[model samples]
Target: MGAPGGYGTGFALIVVLFILLVIVGAGILRF
Candidate 1:
């Protein structure tokens, strides 16, 4: 699974983006 699991990075990036968006939304709501 050397180069076969390269897609994991893309999925991880997407997850990170989602978390960031959620955090930003929470901050906006709090203000």
Candidate 2:
């Protein structure tokens, strides 16, 4: 998926945000 340019940057950002949301949701449930 290394086509270079803006595509990879956007994809990575989306993946990071998704992971962060999952972690926050799990923490809230535990509390």
Candidate 3:
């Protein structure tokens, strides 16, 4: 628990990017 803020920030960013990628991927597949 030395740097929870830093770790949480990175994890949040990865999760957001992953969700965005999934959404974009589905959109491409639909078309």
Candidate 4:
């Protein structure tokens, strides 16, 4: 059976959030 579509989208969102968190943490450390 084929994989469900929502799984891909959810995974992408999680990745984006993780990247955003990393960027924010780096910015905080720069100060």
Candidate 5:
């Protein structure tokens, strides 16, 4: 149970980071 929770948290963090990167890249390209 603990392992699954940790894995899910890590996956969420990675997804958030990926989204931020994509938004930043889009903003830079627009400007």
Candidate 6:
């Protein structure tokens, strides 16, 4: 079922992952 809600959820998940990766990278660089 390719519903509109599914797309929105997937996009949100990707965005969250990207933000987390950025934070982790910054922390590693700080060390």
Best by lDDT: 3
Cα-based RMSD of the predictions, in order?
A: 2.6, 1.5, 1.7, 1.8, 2.5, 3.3
C-alpha lDDT values of all predictions? 0.89, 0.93, 0.96, 0.93, 0.95, 0.95
What is candidate 5's lDDT per residue for 1-31, written digit by digit as tens?
5578889999999999999999999999999
The CA lDDT at 20 in model 1 is: 100
User: Counting only residues 3 or more apart in sequence or on different chains, how many pairs clash (N, Cα, C under 3 Å) in candidate 6?
Assistant: 0
Better of 1 and 3 by lDDT: 3
Estimate candidate 6's alpha-carbon lDDT, on a 0 to 1 scale.
Answer: 0.95
- Per-residue alpha-carbon lDDT of candidate 2 for residues 1-31, written as tens digits (9 for 90 to 100): 5597788889899999999999999999999
lDDT of 4: 0.93
In model 1, which residue pairs have backbone atoms overlapping below 3 Å?
A: none
Off by over 4 Å in 1: 1-3
lDDT of 6 at 2: 65
Q: Name the runs in model 5 displaced over 4 angstroms.
A: 1-3
lDDT of 1 by residue, 1-31 (tens): 5654658888789999999999999999999
Can you write out model 3's per-residue Cα lDDT over 1-31, one digit (the tens) per residue?
A: 6879989999999999999999999999998
* Number of backbone clashes in candidate 1: 0
Off by over 4 Å in 2: 1-4
lDDT, ranked from best to worst:
3, 5, 6, 2, 4, 1
What does the lDDT come to for candidate 2? 0.93
TM-score for each predicted model, relative to the true structure: 0.79, 0.81, 0.85, 0.85, 0.87, 0.87
